[model samples]
Target chain A: MQKLLDYGPLLLGGAVTTICLAVLSLLLATLLGGWGARAKLLRPRGDPLNKGLIRLQARVATAYTTLARGIPDLVLMLILYFGGQRALNWVTELAGLDTLEFSKFLAGTLAIGLLYGAYLTETFRGAWLAVAKGQGEAAEALGLRGLRAFRLVLFPQFVRHALPGYGNVWQVLVKSTAVVSVIGLEDLVGLANDVGKSQRDPFLFMLVVIVVYLGITSVSGWGFNRLERYYSRGMR
Target chain B: MRFDLVFEHWDLFARGVVTTLELVALSLAVGFCIALPCGLALARGHRSARLIRAYVYVFRGTPLLVQTYLFYYGLGVTLGQYDWVRDSLFWPFLRDAWWIALLVFSLNSGAYATEIIRGAVITIPRGELEAARALGLSDRQVDFLVLIPSALRRALPQYGNEVVFMLHGSVVAGVITIQDIFGVTQTFRARYYVAYEGFLTAAALYMAITFVIVLIFRQLEKRYLAHLGLSR
Candidate 1:
């Protein structure tokens, strides 16, 4: 326990990795979710040439989300850790590259993004649906079609509506980075575990783990509240 | 690429899925039993209720994985002297992976379910209780006849959500080397190095299982809420 602080560099590295992974994944998932919701709402029916395309997209999205949400995050992390490396190895072999690396950091980001993207998709979709129908119709009636209509009316309303739920989802995702630690990602929990193993003081390291998570959650909460207020302006 | 792999391994998969289902079902059932009573007791505002609330908050606030590790590793060190608890005649039964997994999951689920039940209990209409009281019924009798039943019904939808969540959550049992579906799938992946096939199959199976659970809940909701159709 006394020597635990000697590994401060490693602990800082873990925190950086954890925060970066969580933030990047949140950004990517939100963007993907926004696009997915838009496609679901605005896309027209499919033709004989593209039979079942819409249903397929919807099912894929459903499957993505269900799989992500249903399985424990630890299990998801295991699959990504082992499976991602294996797949990358296969690809590298085919390209005749002797050694191409797939960093655990990148794998963690991609896995969390793809998994939580399913959840964000549903949140974004619900938000989109909650946007009042009259606002969109009025935008169209005012000859504000295409990008202008979405920019002036729909997008802002969607963000405002989605912010609260999205904030909750982000909190869940941030906590989920703890799962990546099981796969040997040097996140706070992972570093804590290492520190514990080396010092033989599991409780103290676990406490550090808890404090790190609390710190991250508190900061993100402040950021989320600020965002919520900013988006929620100009409303009664 | 080989369909024969599944045919050859059909028994293993079936056994795994059944074990997984049992794990989920037993935990959910036990958890609900503990949760419903605790929730009711906590809502009663007795002197002991504050302690129960603290228990519920700590359990519900932390992630399930953290709880699982705390029970397994943390307890293993501090409480290792209680070897007879897992031993004796019970050791053969309790030492098994499935049962211990069920125990951890049941406790976790019970904590979450407490909140759901507590919320439902608070929402029971006061008018019905007053009517029962006017009939000269005892307080206990009025509660048994009026309060508990309606509160449980109101709590059903949220309870259904928790059920689905637990069903999915049971996959973590695999982490402790339970031969559940997820564990068996990982073994196949490791053995054959067919990462895609193994995970894709596992993912699809998980999706199918969750879909079925959601479908059953939806039907239950429709049946139970039919009385409120006009309001709906």
Candidate 2:
């Protein structure tokens, strides 16, 4: 009751952490996913000699996506948090440098970003494919090429198509941020858990956390819908 | 990296995998039972819709781990007051970490399954329902004989996703001392300080189970839903 109210400032800060993690993870996922999709679609410049490099890109991206998507989110978080930190320690030991303590926020963000990147790969790839072939051909006829063609003709349209799936990924990503609590990140869930346990009102505190998440999701969903409409204005 | 360590702990890993599967299976089964009626009620869209909506909102909106903590820590304290609950034979099992994990996981998943089933039932072809009624079936008979089966079939694929999600979500059982893979992995990692080997083994098992779940769903989809050829 009154004890829980005392936790308002701490819980508010934790909410900020949750939102920050979600936003940063989403950004990283977008970057990785864009690269992954391009890698998946990478073909030679119509030269047999270029095929090897293209094949390698495609293979590397496929492996990354498969491993990221296949592993459970928690397992991935643990692997990166523990094993990745261990590897860093080993390297530092060998190099005679200071041993490192892994920051949970960084590790958690990277793990989620990597995992969701695999999902967004398919999303972006689907969006890309859904684009009209004529658009690309028209870009070529207009003397636009490579990055210019993509920026002008392809990226905008595909981004719009990617919005719906991207929204889904973002929502799931937001929820997955709670899993980051395992690493001792003071996200919303972590704060609720600590305060709940201390106050002996775990259910009441968690109920409040649930309401907070519902609010976040509702607002975000509304925002995404508005953005989607903005991007989709002329289409249909 | 440490094959010897992994081999030394074979029983631990095996038990972990078995329990993980059991947790997911039991929860998914029980959740579906709760979900079916809730879904049907929600899809009917009348007096009961608001109740089902609140259930789904609370469960789906919240993360599963907090709910697990509430069940194990919060309810664990509150329910200790009831002598009847404490004295029952079921209390022995209920006190087990496995049962507690199953209870929270089931309820959280039940909420999700409600939505999935609701969506599926809501989209049932109106023509089929009219034909069933025309054949002189009672409303209850039509629901049981025609609607539920079709809804289950339609919901199967999404339900498979839920099953796998539950599989992944069950990892949170580790927080409450449940002996699932994640829990075992944590114990192994802590005991040996060999994070790489312990987590890698568990990750492989998780990925393998995910593949198997996907394969199972694909076969089910083929067998039960080949009629919707082009849409798939």
Put down candidate 2 lDDT per residue, A1-236, tens digits, no spaces: 78667888899999999999999999999999999999998766767768888888889999998778668787888778877788899999999999888878988899999989998998999998899889999999999999999898888899799999999899888888898988788888998988887887777888778778889888998999999999888888
TM-scores, in order shown? Answer: 0.79, 0.90
| Two-chain DockQ for each candidate model | 0.28, 0.62
Please name the candidate that would achieve the greatest lDDT relative to the true structure. Answer: 2
lDDT by residue (tens digit), candidate 1, B94-130: 5565666878899888988888888888877778788
Candidate 2 wrong stretches, greater than 4 Å: A90-97, A138-153, B79-94, B128-142, B230-232
lDDT of each: 0.74, 0.87
- Cα error, residue B195 of model 1, in Å, equals 4.1
* Local error of candidate 1 at residue B52 (angstroms): 4.6
Highest TM-score: give the candidate number: 2
Tell me the spans in candidate 1 whose CA falls farther than 4 Å from its real position.
A1-3, A7-9, A43-99, A138-153, A218-236, B1-11, B37-53, B81-100, B119-148, B187-197, B230-232
Report lDDT (Cα) of residue A190, candidate 2. Answer: 91
